[model samples]
Target chain A: MAEKKRELVSGSRLVDENSLKERLIVIFTKWEVILAVLIVFEFILFSNLSPYFLDYFNLMNSTFTFMEKAIMALPMIFIIMSGDIDISIASIIALCSFSMGFASSHEIGAAGIVIIGLLAGLSAGMVNGFLVTSFKMPAIAVTLATQSIFRGISQAILEDQAYTKYPEKFAYFGQGYLGETLIPFELVLFLVLAAIMGFVLHKTQYGRKLYAIGNSKEAARFSGVKVDRARFINFTLMGLFCGISAVLLTSRIGSTRPNIALGWDMEVITLVVLGGVSITGGKGNLFGVLMAIFLLGYLKFGMGLINLSAKVMIITTGLLLIIAVLLPGFLDTVKARRKLRRQQKESGMVEV
Target chain B: MSIPTSIKTITQRRETSLILLIGVLLFGVTMRAPNFVSVTNIERIVNDTSILIMVSIGQFFVILTGGIDLSVASMIGLSGMSAAMINQYNPGMPAGFVLIIGMLIGMVLGMINGAAVAYGKVPPIITTLGTMSIYRGMTFVISRGQWVTAHEMTESYMNLPHGNFLGISNLIWWGIVVSVIMFYFSKYTKRGREIYAIGGNKVAAKFVGVEEKKIHMTIFTLSGILSGIAGVMWTSRFAAAVNETAAGFELQTVAACVIGGVSIAGGSGAVVGVVLGALFLGIINNALPVINLSPFYQMFIQGAIVLVAMLINTLSEKRREQELLKGRQQ
Candidate 1:
């Protein structure tokens, strides 16, 4: 009995806060759970407001709208997780699409066009990776400069002209179905990639290094994390995904314009951040982000059914982002204060 | 402190090299288009750059405190659009009153951002990112997607920025006045020093009794006020205000700050550098038209120039660090 009391007084491991009651609270209060509940709530509300909101086919089709962005968000998770950002992703898309269009116009087959798009995006990403990792410039600065440069290259070449022709079968990636399923090819591709990325993030040492770097770059370096190499790879990964997204987008639209994906950077960043990813880095996960993508996608699709203007959706997104960041921060502060008070009380009793 | 060291310092200064580069640019442009170096063209370029100059100064303050306000373009749009609508509906409203109202609107917007960042602990980028679109959305809502055209505005309102003052446009005069006042404010004020201190090292600055929150408030609000002024100038000069007015303009202001050698990490920027950077951009823009290059090429060239300027800024800073280390070793 005396030994048990002593252990209780000093043993943090023995305290096992994972009791049934605590576990229930933790599971229910998880961000992903909250998002799931919110999505369900959105569904009921939208269905009541609009009759066609519940259709399964329409739901499946809605995935096409965000699958490209969702694909881009996979690598974006790594970028933000490592305390870097690439606002140039949308611009990379414009450049890649332009290159692919150029290749198609040259009578190249679908395979060659796809190769050109990926190469364009890869080289573009490499430039950003090189600028950031080698020059030690801030990620925002390098990306902002490159954002302008990449899009500008396309604008200078295209000059208000658009490329309209693509080789046959090129549209399959964007417009085709999976064998006999109603699922989009892009959607299937996203799911497979997301699963792979999720495993790499949660089941690998590389993932742990990202978290360490995000929490403290200096400390991570001292601990021998390959910080620079990891960051470079994240950027290149973002570029490759952008290429994939560009291929999908160009195929779906069947044309490439200079202004294609003009404001997509904002939308993509919003998705990641709203997915419960911390803008400051070192927090959040894939489950939360995936939920955020679907919730926002469906919310937008439902709003369209009711004929609500895109402006209202913009306002809603802004409010949600602010609330998402603020509510959690507020909760954390309260938790911290309570813990601080308890610590003081325990210390005071010991002194007395 | 010695003569040789002082001379070396002068040579190493960014401003010195920037001035030399400007001279080269001017000479090169003159060689291509002989009339480009003329005084009239120079005046025109400066006038055109006046709006960017004001906006860059505003951006400079926020960046000094290691914060970015991505909503700058949106702020410009809403404020400018608001003032333009007032002029369109009530043509009798004084231009000065419209300008003041525009500034007040911007000040309020900035205050919201400052409060969230300084007190609420929301990251500056996220706060601004959200506001960026929200403000634009609000602009559309208020305007009902209608543009305020030049013909709808009063004669006096249109002339506010274009009115000549002793052969110089009022816009150029406004830029000069703002430059002088800001230079004085930054150099002489304790608040300005606090901005630098906080940016350099937040923990150290807080320990030294600097109020990080208040500085954040001041700088962001100041940026808003400046953007407001620029908004008014833009509408008057361009003679139209639309929902998309000044869209994507935040990039140009930031580009000016970066090219002017403002460290993106913050805490170090000068008004002269910002002004020179704006001027350099302005010259390139004007010269591009004269050289017969399509305006489309302008975007490509501008991006390239900013990249070069960014690289130079980094290289020079690194060189300064090495030189300092060598001196310490000696």
Candidate 2:
């Protein structure tokens, strides 16, 4: 009978733990649900606003527009979550694009072109990471300087030249579709990249280290996590991704200009913030970021379809970014108040 | 008070980064074009220096607060466009009024930014970044994508740049006046020291009863005022204005401040250093045009110089920290 009583207590404790887990999941799932609902609402609203918004071709083009942004946002997630930032990604893209232009001028094949572009991006990223870490500089400052440095290099190489002599097959990566449907190659690439990044960030040890480092670098350092190594690797990864984006962008535009990706850094950063990542670091989820990426991309695309100027689209992006960064803190305050109220009510009843 | 120790201490803490950067820049320019020192070249340097000085002064204030005003350039563009529109609408209006109106509009925008950053609790970088888009968008909206033509602006107004005052362009005089005022304010004023105090330790300053929010707002507004002045100078000198004018001026301004020893980390730097840095940058820019070097090569070299400057600053900072550690150990 005593054994049975002890078993009952353990069973109840298990139940309580299970319920706690369920509660956490329930709260976390709300963000995804809200995002899905938002997307559906946006689609319905846009379709009502514009007759052509529902067109497969228009939507397909919209996917292409957001593809590089979404792809680049992945590494940026790791970068920001690790308590660092790189605003030079756009400039990195320019450098990569310019390198490709140089390669094409030298009659290099596609494979060689890809390698060279990636190498340029990696070197740029490494330099940025090295400077930031070794010199103990802020990531923002380092990247700001590198933005000019990389873009300056690109301008030096390409000047006003537009490179366009690639084979028609090259266009497939940016503009073509899979199985002759309405999807673009860039969209497919975005999906593949997003999945890989999600796995790396959510399912890997290194990913956990990123979270730990962001939470507190000192703690992570004491815990045997290699802080600088992770940062350096992540920056290099960001550059590699940026290089890939350059390849897609060059193919899509069918030309390369020195100013091709000018001012894209802020947009990517905006998306990263809107995805619910704390700019101050330590906390974020990839899924929410993906949701935000699509939400923003589609929202802008929808706005574009309704005849908004590109300028207005940028303004809207800025607003969304501000709201996204601030909203989570507001919600936490609300949650804390509610918890306090409930605790007070319970204590009052017990006293009574 | 041993000689070697004192020498080591002075050497460790001194900001030799800017000095080294200036030396390197002088050497590079001298090598590229030995004749880059002609009177004609000096005049060119003065012309470029005027514009950079205006922007650098504004950038210095924002950087001092441990925040950046990315919208400064956009403000310049917006104000330039507005000032030109006013000139085109009524060529007879006092040029001074047009300049004031443009600057006032800029101050308003900056106030909005400061309000968002200080009261709304938005991060300064993000706030300024947003305002940048807003400012530039407003410029495009107001101008309707039209350029302010040279003919629309009056010859007398355009002549202000070509005109000389005290054997220097009025533009250089504007730079000098603004720099002197700023240097005086930063060095001698109570609010100026408060700016440094807040940057050095915001928590400590707050503990000591520093009004953080007010100072932030003031600095941001001041930055906007300077940017507006720059807009006026830029428009008057170019005799034209467009939404995309001064496209990269914000970066250039920041570059000048950084190269001049203005720390991005904040609480450190001076207006005088920034002015000298601006002159250094201006000389480099002007020399490129005179030497007939590819503007592309000039850009490459300028970027390299900025990198080298940052590197030297980092090294000097490390040396200082090492000396401090050594002192503690001894």
Candidate 3:
């Protein structure tokens, strides 16, 4: 009884009300937290810079624009963490969209469209997974091949013509607002997904397995973590998300062109990395990813508001990606220099 | 001992198999299109192969170090534009100086990529991917998305590649010379060996005091110079430059490298192999258009061929690894 009480006291002290300030301190020191703070800062700055920036209509438009790619990015985070990548996501989305469009032309509605889209994404992902796993081909190589393959299929089906025969209601998934506040349905879906993924990544055993698998597949396998199964599941999940995004993208654009979202895979990766997720994997938070999403969305929106050319926007993204990657290294260098200075001050000489 | 033996056996088989495959493909294409074997068609193939070889040689170096340079297409566009503008803007300027300036522009951009990849520690894919846009974007901004036509190009600059020796295209001669040099450098030079070393094991190389940053910068810059030269050659050939010119050439370059047996994972590839790979792709590219396939279909076929080549290469490599593993056990 005495030992149990002692344990309780120790646990209580760990989460003591007085330690809330200390907790906040910890959060501020974290990279993800810093990113989150920067995003909020940018949001405010943009809102102030342009009256249109904070308008509900604008936000909704941007959210819908980003949703399809963002959804695919969630699974991509897992794939990249495992020391692999899927450059074929954009292609997969194209294939799915094309499949849905094909089905719609055949007079298939709603359910049939969803099924066709999902199957297309699934089969594409399966091919990618099999090629990488069985052939031991680099994920980049496999995905590069599949990117062409899937897009080829899309091209074969649609040729130069686009599909636009979808029913009017389907557009709601992409362009509809929830209530009168101008919050998009797609954005709401994104938030719900973000919340669910956040919970899974931060609070579940399965998420722990993903990190473990990513860090070292051999070790994970030896530990009975089912590494291959996890990867299969991850790829499937990526496909499912791709299918979902297809529905939104096809509807939002109101057509399916072969070149729709030609280079979106890179954009998804940029957001993931910018969100403070390690490209090397085994370490990332959805919170950081969320902040990155908003940060990118707002940055583009702000840049657009300023009337920057599309070319300039492309350059800005490139510069931003480079800066985002280098910032951590720069910070580490600065910290090291400070540490050396402090040590020299204390010891009266720099350590050799 | 067993591993070495099996490796040798596999290498021997691959060499013969690749040679046989090319022969068969050549026969098939020639049978289908009787003109494919003619001197004029051969000339066309050589011309196409020359540009692709130049670009692929650079691509081979980077991919041998397990990195991709998506900026090759943009590099081509930028350098081509620069060369054209220099010739047009500065009348009576020495062709050599203009060429040097164009090459230097490529070098600078390549250096930026190297710095970002090496010192910045950004993934090569992300770095090059970003730079791909930035370079092309800058090209548009500079050119205002305008094309430099033959009227704007100078006569001397156009004359550079038109003068052929030994009944061979000068560009083909250039490709052969560059390939030979690259082949020698990759095989015999210390810097060349150092590149393979970095690709093989960056961590191990670091332990042996190999400066990874320096090597990465060097290779990436070399890639840039090669692409730049191609740009110059391309502009001279067509006497035209546009922002969208050579837009998808990076993928083509990549295809050449991969099909040439340059492992995307880095290490263990030969410059000669890549040159041959470039020739293989060049053949397909040359023949496809003669058959009256639409431009779009041509792209689809080219992409499919690349995918097939990669699949084959990877399958062979995997089989070799399995053999080595099994040999060790035996």
The CA-based lDDT of model 1 is what?
A: 0.88
For A291-352, candidate 1 gives per-residue lDDT tens digits of 99999999899999999889988878887887778877886676457557857987999999
* Candidate 2 residue-wise lDDT, B1-330, digit = tens: 999988865554424545665667666777777877667666778787787897788888889888888888888998888888888899998887887887897788778888887877777887877778888888888887889989999876676566788788888788888889999999999999899988889999999988999988988988888888788778888888977889878877887887887788899888977887787788777667666777886666767767776776677777777988999999
- On a 0 to 1 DockQ scale, where is model 3? 0.59
Better of 1 and 2 by DockQ: 1
Q: Is the docking of candidate 3 incorrect, acceptable, medium or high quality?
A: medium
Return the candidate ranking by DockQ, descending: 1, 3, 2
Per-model TM-score versus the true fold: 0.95, 0.90, 0.90
Point out where model 1 deviates above 4 Å. A1-29, A340-352
- Using DockQ as the measure, which candidate wins? 1
lDDT of 3: 0.80
Ranking by lDDT: 1, 2, 3
For candidate 3, state the interface root-mean-square deviation in angstroms to 1 decimal. Answer: 1.7
Q: Ten residues in a row with the worst lDDT in model 3 chain A?
A: A21-30
lDDT of 2 at A117: 83
lDDT of 3 by residue, A133-224 (tens): 76777788877767777887788667799998897777788888887767888888888887777787778988888888777788888999
Candidates in order have lDDT scores of 0.88, 0.81, 0.80
Clashing pairs in 1: none
